[model samples]
Target chain A: MIRGLRKWAVPFAALLVLAGCGYDDTTVPKPEAVVTTPAVPTTPVKCDNKLQSYAPSDNRGAAIANLANKGRLVVGVSGDTLRLGSRNPETGKIEGFDIAFAQRVADELGVPMVVRVISAADRIGLLEKGEIDMVARNMTVNCDRWSKVAFSAVYYNATQKVLVRADAEKDYKGPQSLSGKRVCAPTSSTSVDNIKAIQPDVVAVLALKHTGCLVKFQNGDVDAITGDDTVLAGLAAQDPYAVVPKQGKLTDEPYGIAVNKGDVALARFINSVLDEMRSDGSWKDTYDEWLKPYLLVDATPPTPVYGR
Target chain B: MSQTATPQAAPPPAAAATAPAPAPAVAAKPTPGLVDTPALLNRWQLIGMTTAILFGVFSALIQFGGWQADGRAADDTEQLVRVQEIQSSLLRADALATNAFLVGGLEEPEQRKEYDDALESVLRQIANAAEAQPADREVLATLNVDVTAYATAVAQARDNNRQGFPIGAEYLSGASTELRADALPILDALVKANTDRAENAMAGQHPFWLLVLGIVALVALVWLNRELAQHFKRRINKGLAIAAAIVLVVTVVTAFAALLRDNSNDSLREGELATAVSEANARTAANDAKANESLRLINRGSGEGFEDLWSVSAKEVEKFASRDTRSGWDAYVAQHNEIVELDRAGKWDEAVEIATKEAGGSTESLDAFDQLSQQIVTANGTQATDDLRSGRVVALVLSGLTLLLGVAAAVAVSRGIGERRREFA
Candidate 1:
């Protein structure tokens, strides 16, 4: 029996010795592709704009005309916004309220709409960098954006306002009540700058995305999300959150397509399209199609004021 | 056994041949007789010698058995210790996953902050421990991926909460749910794998004492038997008796070593394994319960979403029940069922209240889980500690003892063989 056991032991030992640790080599999934569309040229390409001379202070006006003739419309846009220049999870497409407007101008220009996605702070610099021809990313016309870039017709009228949790709606009225509370808005937009200018004591957190600003409100990270009514309305669609500073517009957030200072003709072309869009009901159609989903059905059309 | 051992029986033929002449050789020369007893003996002599040989064979067998047991026990203990630390972290992870689900679901200020703090801590602990551990790359990688998901969930949760969007809860709940579901099963698998090690540790303690005792017993018996022959004034056959005695003792110790090892394994299987599996199951259930509550909120009785979140969280709770469980989570299940029914009926307020009660009760906390989870955690912890108990001093001392005992057995066997060799010459 001992001899028999000894014979078996060696094989058992060998088998145990050969026993190896388990292993599995799983293939790692590659990172998802981000479709990087080419940036539009910001140099003044509006050859038609060269026919007319504009004031030297029109830094943005001169640049748009130089950039537009290159057959590319460098329209400054936002990439972080959903339903407007935001990523579409299904088709991997970027679409929204503002993009269509930019597309229409580019389409009318007979140029490729190379949308230069940007934060508001860089809108002016991008035009200066000759990296974009126009800014249509819901930019508010104030002394600030106007000082850097010449404006065109205001297509959309925006207002600075407050968004709060539905529960808090009963108490909060305006800037004074919002004191000691945090407010958020995308940096370089009129809402944040205006909040600073108006409710200077209000703590403001500047986020890159308006959605982010709105989320801060939801997380109770802030008391209010302060931005253009258009942006805030977009935020409200995703959540049941309410907008405050209840009635009437704050500082008039006049939506304009920013152009280089000297580019009168491209501005004229843009102006004519706005005119055509307004007269031909394209402007109303765009609003009815895009912004209508998030706004009141009785949303009144803002009168388009022409640039000098 | 026959299939493999048939060829091995070849050596016994030679032993039979050598067996005949030992008695004659013992008579011819006293000096040669000492070394040459068994080799010079025939079949009858060998057969007669076998009875006396039992002690020696048993002693050697006992010594070997003890040595094997000692080695296995040492390895088992070391592994269990390591497993325990990992298991504890995993346990905590399961709890935090539930917390994340709960907080993300509520998107309430207190809950969100709590979830964030707990999850961040879990991630940090996992990272810190991972650096110190010698875990498989795949396991480590998976853990890292889980951490990233956790981080993303936290970020997104924060974002959505700020916006007052319920989707933040949905995202966080999703992260916690998927992770808990996938993660616990893997951890349970890890715990199950070390069962053999736990048994080996328990069995290891006995072999050294058994070996030493066998050596002592065999020596005493051989000395007593040899002197008995010498007292009679005859060259008595005592070596075979000693050898035979050794064989029996060795066989007993070997069998005992194996038995004790099996006993330890049984202990681990019954104790730690059961605990790990049960606790993991409970944790997953808790997570599912929380997730279901969150989904109920996210769905908000909207469109097809009500059906979707319902299916997801329902499956999770059920999966926990199917796995091994320690405590009867019947209380939790009862609450969950009511919540689900209320949810199905679109009674949001009632479901929310029950959810709050179920989630908030300190007694039903995931840390304890009604004693079952605690017991399971303890069992797994105990099993896991075998390989992982820390302190270099204890390890050094244990290792030294094992080595000394092994060396002592080997030397004693070698000496016995040398003494028999002289008679064979």
Candidate 2:
């Protein structure tokens, strides 16, 4: 019995030695595998469309008084965004649909609109910091943003879509065609996220600006440029090689002027101004002048959807 | 009881004659066999000899450290700037290539021109980087090969695309993969190596030898002064004391300058270097995300793969982003989800519209990143410049001090010997 036990013990010891050698080098920690979870809410964003127009008053709110005292409507506009809010390189004048809207606000306030060239990232922060009194640089009104800042109204309703090369045999008609294709979008916009949600297999590239995506699309670095129809139209216009498919719209983006969270009186006043603009056909005239060429069709201004 | 003036009163000749008598004696105590001679090292002569040796060694040490530090300042900054240039050019080239391809087979004239210009810029940047870092020639050579391959692939892909071939997309995908996997890793390695080199240079302080020399010189001076005082029945040798004081002062000054250089290097590594690295990574992520977008169109319906890629890169960019850019990143993420939902629900056109829309979506996020990254890059550059300048200045000062100390040590000892020699003569 002792001899048999000894034979088994020797074999067991050998096995242990073999295991120790393997174990010694394999103890390093492995990096955790990243799992992508869909962050889109199953329930659509809840929006409030309540709008009680403010009565015109001589006693301006603190925000309005501050702007009046400053003698200018400090409005933040995108300098690089083309056909929307951009500075003319030769003229050095800020011109776009957003700029026009901002100017209207200045006109009502009896002050000049001092256009401060700002990027999309600065829209909310600049308002909160009081660096700019209002942000009209193609800002979209959403539930997430409403919590942080006040929106005037949905001044413009834009649709999301794809811009692709026109001469291609197989048209990227919809998200299904975009599955394996590379799509370029600005990091500051919802385009990339939308592409990700629609077809998780689609390669989404985020650029610093829409122009960055446009450039990438034109260079064959990306298969298509995915964004709002308005912006896609502008990009398509720039490059005769690209076109927006007449297939369908991706999502509805309601553009609004953003004010600081605490500026309720100013927001109401701005909403009233928007209401007047919508009724008087002033908004349509502005849209036609700045956005009509890219839009290719005369679309009426979106009715105000105020979240108050 | 002053000794009679004698020409043979020099220390060296006396030491040579009685050298055998004290050959085995390591003790400092003097005996009768010892006599003063300029030819031999008596205690005072010994002081002068040790001082000269110590000062010479210390001077070499200080000079070597200064030269090394100065070289590091130039090399590190140049490498860093080169890395930045290369990174920018590579990213731009990739963007241009993709945009050109997106224009279909014919490729738009303006877009083609832009692509050509971007490629040319990348070549120039690589050449510039190579000129500065000869040791990186091997890595640059690999990059050069890879870039050529990428360009060739793109051109072929273009031809196929113009003919309306589906295979064109495949070629384009292959090229993009090569650039991301093969090219980027090499560039990253180059950056890491240069950073390490800079850190090593900054931390390179070898004052131990100088300290030992200073201590030894001081000991020799004190012992010699004591021995001389006993021989001449005087309490001090003013010249030797002055020499010792100069050595002490210069050593302290040299040490302080080295300290300054070290501190400046630390500041640069912790502040500017850190910021630069973070921004570079963010930029890379942003560019990668753009590249993945194109891949989504190639694969068509399986865009979730690209989405995963974008998600990782976006998170990385967000991680390094400053406060100003954080809000933009958050918004971009929110928009991304809506775009995805639209696509998944068969509203591909709608998803595209939202994605391409103005004032929101990826544009907002990208703008935010750009602003913050630009700010970070500027700040990093300023800080790096300040730190490099500080290091160079400290090196110059230390080098100058070493030279001054060497001269002072020589002058003080010579003057002391001259005074005694005059008395003896």
Candidate 3:
């Protein structure tokens, strides 16, 4: 019996050992690389009077008829530009300096206000497509944009400025102070280009929006953020460590309300609304309510230019 | 009973004298009238005993392999389910966080607690899965890093949101994007690995091999019996016959058991295990869709991109949802459609109200579906694993018995050949 068992013992023991074999180490597959197409460049358009708009008129009926969605003034604005146009966490409503102007236009037109949150890059496209009645999202009036869409006269005289750490605020004097430092701005906004053009040595980083830049700043991914004084003021208000030191402006960013190129009547109507805001002291009240605390300065609305 | 030895036939005197003297170095040649019957009998005994013993070891070893395979299949199934649960819980946490963001600063405390609990469950499961499956440890470590990054970003978002900063929304959106990009793919790999392990393990039962082994052993036994019978007057040797019968019986019984086990495993792989995996997929997709819904709302008017993602996730849920959980999913889909209609009509506030409300809302409806799907996954997964593990002890005992029975058969062969030798002497 022992000999019989011994004959197969080696193979049996080998089988048992094989049973204890382990599997190979598992692996995670790497994600496929994203392919991005290079952007096509277009020639910059130059016009004599980019700030000029249609003369103001009180024609609510025609303006309402020209709306993309009748009975609702679908105006695109930023929901992240704090004092200019941002959503209130407490009330869950968009209320700020820019939103005040949007609400006033809708009220005068006797229509409901529908606030569409949009990025700076989308403002021109949305207006030209007639997807929105107007854009009040701190859009800067320039010659290139004037060919694509009509603009209400400059409503606020904003100047490009840089916001840096509070500790570094004293050393900042001009765009040259940002040379070789990483400066972030909204991707399609003119602020990054303006700073880069002036210093040439500054590393320009772009994000989806100004608030996205602020996120990068808080995370120490960028050395400074650059945008309009009004936008920088809002960003500064959010972070105590950030400060916009007194410095020469990189460029004059004249804010405007944009409409479709063919919507002259709506553009005139928006100018009329702006005229009312200026005369009734409502614009001042709005500026005081939303911008004064952060800007630390008293301000008056810009004189509206007309006769385009 | 002791039997008297039979009288041997004496060799002829002339034949013994004529046989050459035995060589010192080589085996002596057989005389013309004499045969070496004892040597021949020893060779037959060795062949018969070796065949019987080898048959016993190989068959038992095969059965033992099947038993171990079933155990591994059960463990792999459990790990598969556990990894899937971790995926579902991670998405569940994201859904809760995004939905709470829709409510603004003061999120519902219960919802907050649920989010916390879901994240805690994910972390705990990741640790357990690492411990359960060593092959998965590396990926789980990377997943832990991604989850930690997401959690940190969410905390930052909450802090900014409390201060009413719009950057909070950016932080939340960024965290959501990172979670999908970094953490989800690792989980996908883990799920696929465990799934393959479980399915392959289920195929381990080999009834055909067992049957073939039995047939080969029986042929050897028959050949030995034939050789013994040709030399002896008896047509059949009693001990050899008993040994052959034992081999035949063990072969049939073990092969039948193996066949039954193979069929049972096939049924489990198709039925209960399939259901568990499907329901888990549905639950994960459901949570992903819900998170997209909240993201659409959070993005407000520019949420067309998020809406497109929601459509894709909804289709996944529809495809994988089980029959018992379909009603809940259908109800949630109806509510989601309503939210979409309201949002498209530019009634964003009303849409948000419907989405964030505690009752009669999309959140409540989706919660119902999520709960039902989770229950189905747990119950069916447990049942599948339990079925795989149930007959382990019996298989082990049978293996041991087979080895002992082979020894007994070998002894029978030895005794039968010894009896023949005694008769020859």
Candidate 4:
């Protein structure tokens, strides 16, 4: 028996070696860092009155002809900004303060309204490209945008402000309180530059939209979020922990409806609609319904300025 | 002649006494030193036996190594397919989740269940992969953490969406971004590592080495036969001849078997294995494209970025799609192009309608392509692994038989040399 075992030793040893075969531990490759281009600063164009627009006219025929799509009024608006222009989950319709204005313009033109959701950065580019007839998203009139796109008269006077965690609300006095803290704002918005100008030391982060900033604030990625008071109000209503404390405005963000630079007739038509909303007292009523509870202030529509 | 007398002869003593007065002419040719014939025969027998036995051991070992390599190749192929399945499943889950979000807060129940099922498959497969391959355990562990984080974020997004919060979109977007950044690279590494291991293991058949070993053994046996024949006055030693014959037969047979196995492995690596890997890639790309479609709608008018991403993923699908899946992919592409046209024409509602509809939509075509590609991957992957494993048992048995044959040849050598010794005595 011993001899027989000895005779089978080589095969048995080979089997043992085969059984013990193993590989080196596998390794995971490190993820490559995502590269993003920093926003470039351009020379600001100078203009006397950025809030100026073509004088109001009831030339609905010319404005309808200027529509990119013949039968429908394609208006770009925000789908994520809650009180201004956002989708309602139950109704599956985008209805808010800004959307109401767009709907009125479409109604007055005797056309169907097509709401196109867009980001803050694409507001001017989409207008210039003739993709939308007008942008009723809470876009501000500024000298830089005035060179690229035409705006209707200022309809709402908004002010930029900062929102902080509710626990940090007591210490927040103004932009100075956010010094040396991370603050998030929508990319391409004037609010980031406004906050940075005031404190000069606040680290400004950017998101695709205001709600995106709220997400960052909730995730503790940023200590505060800065945007228009109305936009901040919408963001604050979503999170109980977030609060926009009583603070002075960083800048007067005069809201306007942006149209293509060459679409002066459409600009005139939008102003006409805004004028009607103001005369009919519907503008104040819409404000009371949407912005009153959260803003805690009675407001009136900004007087439309024209003569461009 | 008297000095050269055999030691076994009785006359050697008398001859030793009488032959001393012999003539010394030409310095009397020196008598060849006495050879211990038995010792020489014993030495030749030992050399011959050892050569045959060693040939058996080494050749059998080579064959055994080949057999083991096939088994390992099968295992590696299985692991490769498993990692790829995890990749596809994760993307499939993302596609379902993103598509469901297009319907607002109240998502379709079936769609939600599909998303859940896909995610569950990913988690379960990760665990299975870790258990199957010890080498991949660490990466799979990290992957598990990333997947859990993604799931948590999606859950938050869903809860918020149900309550009509716009921040829910942000949550979903962040989750998708994190999944691609954190989880995908690990999966890529696993795919690469297993691909290399499987290919390397498949190439393990060494027909050249087997041939070389056989030739060297044959040469040694032939030389031993020559040495024995020089003394025994025969051109061939029967025992050595038999051993050489055994060596030749075993070399031809085992070498041929190894060559056949090598060719089979090559075929499998290029055919079924390639199909499985490429089809799996196509499936993953298809799912990625579908997710980008939903994301474009989610982002609404500013979704040009997502549209560009969709184009890229669609191109990837086109590049990797097999003939079997091309028709389904083509149908999906046509539908996708129609949606893009409608979106560009500012008919977003119409585009969303076509995109979100249940039947005759881009979703249905893409689903068909995904399912077909998945089936192809499973079938071809199983075939490749099975082919590698099927005849391994026969290979093992052949290896053992070669060893026994070697020993038999060694015994034949001993007996044949023993006959020469007996004749001399």
Best by TM-score: 3
Error of 2 at B170 (Å): 1.1
- All candidates: interface RMSD: 13.7, 21.9, 3.9, 7.0
**iRMS, model 3 (angstroms):** 3.9
Model 2, A122-228: lDDT tens digits are 67887888767888877767776776787776778887888887875265558888888888887667777877887899898877667667656756799888877
Would candidate 1 be rated incorrect, acceptable, medium or high by CAPRI criteria?
A: incorrect
Model 3: per-residue Cα lDDT over B172-259, one tens digit each: 9999999999999999899899999999888877778878987887788788788888888777887788888888888888888888
- lDDT of candidate 4 at residue B171, scale 0 to 100: 86
TM-score for chain B of each model, two decimals = 0.55, 0.80, 0.93, 0.90
Q: Put down candidate 4 lDDT per residue, B1-425, tens digits, no spaces.
A: 11111222222223246565556562233334745576667777777777777888878888988888899899999999999999999999988888888877589899999999999999999999999999999999999999999999899889888999888888888888888888988988999999998998899888898889889989988888787788888888787788889989999999999999999999999999999999999998899898899888887766889989999998889888999999999999999999888877767777877788899999889889999999999999999999999999989998999888888788777777877776777
For model 2, report DockQ: 0.01
**TM-scores, one per candidate:** 0.42, 0.51, 0.94, 0.90
Which ten residues in a row are the worst by lDDT in model 3 chain B?
B1-10
Top-lDDT structure, candidate number: 3
In angstroms, give how far residue A59 of model 1 lies from its true place.
Answer: 62
Tens-digit lDDT track of model 3 for A236-302: 9899999999987789999999989999998999999899989999999998999889888888889
Ranking by TM-score: 3, 4, 2, 1
RMSD of each: 18.0, 19.9, 3.5, 5.3
lDDT of 4 at B413: 79
lDDT of 2 at B306: 78
Q: Measured by TM-score, how close is model 2 to the native structure? A: 0.51
Ranking by lDDT: 3, 4, 2, 1
Alpha-carbon deviation at A193 in model 4, angstroms: 2.2
Model 2: residues >4 Å from true position, as ranges? A1-308, B1-47, B95-118, B205-213, B354-364, B371-375, B390-394, B417-425
